[model samples]
Target: MHPFSRSQEAKEMFQAQSHLYNHTFNFISSMSLKCAVQLRIPDVIYDHKRPMTLIDLASKLRIHPSKATCLYRLMRVLVHSGIFAETVVPRDGKQEEEIKAYVLTPSSCLLLNDKATGLSPFVATMLDPALVSPWHFLGDWLGGNNHEDCRDKLNNPFEAVHGVNIWDYGRKNPEFGNTFNTAMAGDCQLMNLVIKDYKEIFEGLNSLVDVGGGTGTMARIISEVCPGLKCTLLDLPHVVAGLPESESENVKFVGGDMFESIPSADAILLKVCTLGIALL
Candidate 1:
């Protein structure tokens, strides 16, 4: 083929593969986010109070100086994905150095743990390996029947692959359970911001039930902000077990199965698991 014809064919091939390229590299985005969380990059940047240069960030991250180049490459991809932002800062008048400094955008801001509107937990929950691997079995699960009997089969793709529900697995593993709860609490923190904005939702509510309300984070926040409204945290017995006996006047804990029967309340806040939400 002529050189011009070959160039045209190459461009067409690239266009055809563009979507597949996106799909394949999607995991890199998640992994990059995961790396950031693991390295506490968001927290570091937040604490820095200013954009952090690559060397400074690497030092803060406890990464050796030799790995600085690798860090820069990772940051480049993250910046491209909009998880981190890069800016040029001038240190001295003599030379303006092109240093890669990370600044938090709306996306990275949500990853902060201290911020009232932080969504770190949502990220942790969504990216939980236990929860994520189930998606691979979606096609296989959907091939089965649609009856109530299939509910277990349908709702349990994770179990099918990993041999246990996420909660069960978390229970057996303390660190993972902590990570899961942190994520949930983070999500609750952010959600409460929205809920507070819509206070009318609780204007007439004397009592409210947070179904599957692990740790009562959301319910407690609601109860605290709206003192008159009593809150009940309804969750699995296993989840509520060993949690300190309630001392808060506005909030009470009730351990029970939401699938069978929800506790009686003026309002019910059924916080569905994200994995469950995704399946539905």
Candidate 2:
């Protein structure tokens, strides 16, 4: 091959490799977001109520100075993902020594824990190690290795990784169980606030049953709108065992398996697990 032809081929190969590598490691963005939320980076910037300098933000977070550069790198990716915005701030209102500051973008405003519709818990739950570990077994699962992880034998990727279904595993682990429940509640509540715009969807509905409704989050949210419409939330016994006991005017919890029987209703709602490995 000619020298120029070889160089062009090398450039093309480099571009292709970069593209493939970027897509392969895209999960890093989600992991970074999880870290920032866990550390309350967004909350800190929100509390400041103005653009926050990296040094001051770190001080507020009480992070050791050694990780200052790492923190900046984390924030840099977050800004690139549009979760946060970076801007130059003049120190003491002087332009001579400008420092980079972080501000919450519109996309991140929904991550606030104090907000009724905030998705902080949901994001945390989605990114939890217990939930994320199964992804490593996806290739194994697809390659016909999805079975027998010591405690339980199953074909699901999550089961293969955790030895049991997510719900069963969560039931045994209180911390993970609580996190899973809280995450679902936050997601449902946020969706509830959003679904109000589609009033036609709820029209003519007298009663609804929410299958696999963890902690009655979806039922509670929907019932608030459909005051006259009855809502029954059904989930695994272990899951519902930790949910509310008292019944609301329109909402009630039923600790039962959907496969056995779900409370009869005019409509049945299914909130599919998005982790892609959670089995029925």
Best by TM-score: 2
User: What is the clash count for each candidate, in the order shown?
Assistant: 1, 0
Q: What's the lDDT of the predicted structure labeled candidate 1?
A: 0.79
Please, what are the lDDT tens digits per residue for candidate 2 over residues 30-83?
Answer: 999999889988789999989999889989999899999999899999999999
Which 10-residue span in candidate 2 carries the lowest summed lDDT?
145-154
Q: lDDT tens string, model 1, 102-172?
A: 89989998888777656766676677777777788777666757566443463467766666667678788
Q: Name the regions of candidate 2 deviating beyond 4 angstroms.
A: 1-11, 144-153, 245-247, 277-280
Q: Estimate each model's TM-score.
A: 0.82, 0.88
